[model samples]
Target: MSVAELKERHMAATETLNSLRERLKERRLQLLDTDVAGYARAQGKTAVALGPMDLVCCRILQGHTGKVYSLDWTPEKNRIVSASQDGRLIVWNALTSQKTHAIKLPCAWVMTCAFSPTGQSVACGGLDSICSIFNLSSPLDKDGNIPVSRTLTGHKGYVSACQYLPDDDSRLITASGDQTCVLWDISTGLRASVFGGEFQSGHTADVLSVSINGANSRVFVSGSCDGTARLWDMRVASRAVRTFHGHDGDVNSVRFFPDGNRFGSGSDDGTCRLFDIRTGHQLQVYPHPQDNSTPTVTSIAFSVSGRLLFAGYSNGDCFVWDTLLAEVVLNLGSLQNSHEGRVSCLGLSADGSALCTGSYDTSLKIWAFGGHRTVI
Candidate 1:
């Protein structure tokens, strides 16, 4: 080979080596950034901090004259829908802390409320045994009260909880004190499927909470006063596919983990348990130190990544538990400005950036990681 050709090849190899080194350096920096953001999400924060995973009260939404029985955040994260025994369902602008609209129900015993998937409507039900639906764009009456667009009738007892099916807002599921969970088709205003009744192999007592699996919308699980949690398929509502027995008292709340293969339940037994749906086994139980009185878990919510479980107790205590470690990492009740009465319901925002809790004290509190974060 000629000496000139040898020199040219040598220079080419050196340039190639330099380019490879630059790419490797960029990759290392990317990995470091990812590690930091991942740590923040796993620790339930936006940045690395020194304290425990805590939720600071950013807003205390007032105006309800009666107990706030249920609250749900809209998909836009800027609005909230709350139901109260005051016979009103109020939609609030969380960004401005203003009541955007209020609907007066014919029945004053409203218990549960939920925002539809599209954020265009709201559904609520209670002691009237009728689930009422209202459209936000519809014209309001002189009193700023909107008329019910649809009224779902047929539940034999008080409706305890109602939620829209994920991805499909036209359908919803409602649990009732009648010991039944019914899937309703809102568009047709008819019952689509019924899960339990006196003849069905279902809960012997009232069904309190129902959680539909987002991964497979055809399946859902319910917690009942009979001290059991049952999984049912929407197609075959004749009976439950699996029954979980662990809580010694009534299971008040049930929420699906992110993967939808597992679920968490809070019970009157003063214990929160994780159940594996596929294996039909109890994975873990979260129990507090015994005292003279035990607090019943009233509501529960799972984090977006399924790493944390937020549970509200009847004693007005809200706990954030580490799913893998089975530890209470944060206690909102111990914090200042916490609820003074029973926490009836709680929900995590769509973006997982905020949480809202409704209480029997007739108020709702917005909680997040920062102290006094501006709503805007």
Candidate 2:
């Protein structure tokens, strides 16, 4: 065929495929009931008013020499474990801002970290493609280092995110750049179940984040570079329970709502979306107003009641959104003592009294309800 004819034929084929995909999506959505957002509006639902004094930076934990990439709070809510580019994982007493344990990592490129439910151990992973566990109860070596108690290895690409199963230190879940999520038997250091592979219905690109349902440990959601978030059940490793599509860019983070029946996802599209698990429909979309620059969302967390969504952006803006109203109720980045660099990660304390955010400025700040008007 002539060059012009060949190019025309290729363009036509691409258009046909795109059209087909959209039709399928529409058909699937049609089967869902009324969206949650519409129902809320019809019922005249509104979010509680929050003022600047409602939440304030209470403490700043500063010890890392390099950018802080990730952090997690202990279930007891008094301690925090942070991983930094400095190649160190420091466990801090959030109240006193004291470092109780500072251990050097074998791999410096760590991207994610989590505190076990009991707070007795911490898990972290990164470019090493392995999740390393450190037991705080273990004695330090003669070199003054807390050794890795166990390492879960199998991912063919970088380990992007990791989280311990709720109340079960013996099990963990990890998302990887290899476009898969794996459940690991922590004790045996073997794969308990692998979700998504050549024979499975999974993400086509890198799986960047995973959040397990607090209410039901069997269910979890994952965000990926393919611009989709998928719901998976640990019991069924061969296929995803559902695949959610809406974002125009990579889904950077996925968080389970406090109720566990819904989830929130932040994407490179500069938007955060709420999806209902039961109905398989997107309930709401929180979009940042377009300006000269739209920063990517790096991480997100939800308040205990699921009323507030805390999203961290690449421009160092930590926006607190009213989940019900889909409005920016407060900008933690504009507050006094905010981070000087990008907000890389954030999490709420188990009690819902405070929030801890890690930044590229090499510091983590704790924010708590400040005034009499306590709005979590």
Task: Return the TM-score for each candidate structure.
Answer: 0.84, 0.94
lDDT of each: 0.86, 0.92
Candidate 1 clashes: the total is: 0
Off by over 4 Å in 2: 1-17, 27-39
Q: Residue 165 deviation, candidate 1, in Å? A: 0.6
Tens-place lDDT digits, model 1, residues 232-310: 9999999899988778899989999879999999999999888889977677788755586988888899878877788
lDDT tens readout by residue for model 2, 207-283: 99999999999999999999999999999999999999999999999999999999999999899999989977888
**TM-score result, candidate 2:** 0.94
Count clashing residue pairs per candidate: 0, 0
